[model samples]
Target: MTANKAVGPTEAIADFVQQADFSTVPVEVRERALAAFVDTVGVAIAGHGDGGFQTLLSTMRPELPTGRATILPTGERTSAMMAALLNGGAGHALDFDDVADQIYGHPSVVLVPVVLAVAEEVGASGRDALTAYALGFEVCCAIAATMQVREHYQRGWHSTATIGVLGATAAAAHLLRLDHTRTRHALGIAASTASGSRQNFGTMTKPLHPGLAARDAVLAAKLASNGFTADPAQLEGPLGYLAMYADSADPSAVARALGNPWELARVGLNVKKYPCCYNTHRTADAILDLVRENPVRPEDIAEIRLTLEPDGFDPLIHRRPQTGLEGKFSPEYVLAAAVLDGKIALASFHDEAVLRPAAQQLLRRVSRHESAVPPIGSGEWEFAYSVVEVETTGGEVVRHRTDVPRGDCRAPLGRDDLEAKFRDCVTFAGTGLDADKLLDELWQLETTGSAGPLLNLSASS
Candidate 1:
């Protein structure tokens, strides 16, 4: 993964990771990253029982060593690597973590968990943890920028796990304070294990992808710090990470992306309003807009049509999902639930909510189609959008389109909305965690003594 710092992207990245400091990060970027921590912890709390995580933990708990690293809401202690895996998976179990359009994956789920766990293991200060996270995110976005990524995504490689492993590695390596040479080795170790298939979408395995990435990253960094070695030229080599994964590799993409404009400041992160596949957010927002304005009853609707540009429906594979997890990926299910419930809440994704007779009948009334047209000036379909049209039994048609749903960088949720979301998830999980105290702690994370106690503070009684 090492390239010349003055001459190549990957090397410049290693240099950046080694040198990054929290005080040097801009105020706005730090604030956004802080908000990301609060949102991620809240959603992960709500995802406690979903994704078959409890069952998976039953198998792991017997051998899991008790340590300072804490799992969200559970108050349980485990080794740093196990905590990272558990917390990362739980953070993404609801698919509600922040997203970056650049990578088409959740960043905080991988970076935050890795930073927190490794920071705890190393007794690093919160300021250092926060800086490590930003560095990791930049590295993740940098790698994604280095190729013709449409193929990597279209071919079903979940970049969150594939690219995110390296991000996690960068964060952990930085927190571990590995020098440039060891950091390169850590990234190389990460590349060797980075993998997550899009085929796992809609299943428990989907959320587990980020957890595995987090675990692999911690392992990679710890190993490199302990003198493990890997192929130094694992990035742009003829058969390296980028060569094998990217359809078309760019020799300079990585160099151009790493902080030239600062991806965090440019692309920014998306705070999700709904707890489902991000691909379905536009459709959810659009359909909800249509129904709330029209005041049409579910039974009075004859058909609901969802239209998008090519590959828009690629991640929405389950049309008549039989389970709650499956419903998270179903536009049909979301449209039906949104129309009936007035909002897409944590309750909306429960098995009973998904399988209820009314929801199932309404689901059948939805039909999805794709086209090749963008919104005149949007340029490409990569910036995904959705169009929803509702036709009532009286033949009345109403339509709505959502290009940037609320909570997007352009249409961010306000502070009250963000805090309300955190409080709601706490209540929904019946966690009894101190939401107000936790919110204050998160906002002041940079000044805190250690990052580990923050999670322990949020643990349910």
Candidate 2:
């Protein structure tokens, strides 16, 4: 299959999403996509009662007109747009969602909700949803690849909401079965709605970014399906999305890399082991490693130093967090939790836990430094490396460097580990849903006739 070199950026992406074949997707890619689906669903269900999710629900649920889509765990049926907003926010509320290095943000959190909501609305099969997911993941990564990721990210545009809006639009458009022209219009419309700031990090608004993207994407697709119009050149034209958001935009990158080798198989998703920011995972892994190898009790620790890639430190926005949400972006809080508990768990980020006397004491001794050398990889790949040095009061220094965190594609979580995480998330949320059954259905998600049964399992009884 030759790449469509003649089409414009928006058209190329829209056509790809509209026409991609699920059977052609490699077995490994399909497996990874399903894993992402299961992981995202688990996280969304776990966020059922999150303050941010609840806030959005309270605001939007009452206003939404009647529809068939169900909000996970809550089981509130609403318009696809409303359900996408609610479920997307819930998926990311805890900062526990998965990440992709290529997109520089959470992909599944935004994409999955949009696909599921639209699929339910159209009564599309689970296979249709999975195909949309793979295509959406590809579109998000390809568009992100064309930009100066570090510069764009440092400039405060949250890629999950910004780039992810387009990805979600592609997914929703595909499931809506829009033709190439309408799909292009959907992408263009989504560009206008694409906006989020990293400045909102650590606040309820951070998760709201993806939620907003999901909602807007659904609206963009629905409107496009009904002949709503947008400038087809909105991606690369002067004063368009890439020009405004990116320091240097390569529009050709989008068309050039549409689907020769799917990004789902290439720059794969990073399934998170810890429930905090993906930025904090490598540090958490290093701390766990250091403590496990050498017995360094919290009391025996003198000082801990973290050396990270310069760009990698951008997302660790909170140095001294007063709230649990803030703590997720605080490397200091994560390191403290790791040393104190010997592991960072969902509960570790709770307000009471983050504010504990022991963790606070450790926070005071923790410091961060940026390395002179850039991270070993390209683009946002720099975020994958971290160096941790721990000095104990007993005059011993221990250091560990992590290039691949436990849940990264290079060292993916095994089936058992992923299942355990799903079960743990369900238990933590107190959603009372059957974790085993949900897991089974998600693993076989592509085989299901409709997304309704799978989505229903996520709802509370």
Query: The CA-based lDDT of model 1 is what?
Result: 0.83
Task: Write the residue-wise lDDT of candidate 1 on 160-267 in tens digits.
Answer: 889899888988988888998888888888889989998888888998999999999999999999999987667877878988899987756676666666678777
Against the true structure, candidate 1 reaches a TM-score of 0.95
- CA deviation > 4 Å runs, candidate 2: 373-383, 451-454, 458-461
**Could you tell me how far off, in angstroms, the CA of residue 25 lies in candidate 2 after the best superposition?**
2.6
Model 2 per-residue lDDT tens digits across residues 275-349: 999988889998899889987889998999888876678899899888899999999999999988888998887
The candidate maximizing lDDT is 2
Q: What is the C-alpha local distance difference test score of each model?
A: 0.83, 0.85
Give the TM-scores of the predictions, in the order they appear.
0.95, 0.95
After the best TM-score superposition of candidate 1, give how far the Cα of residue 214 lies from its true spot, in angstroms: 0.4
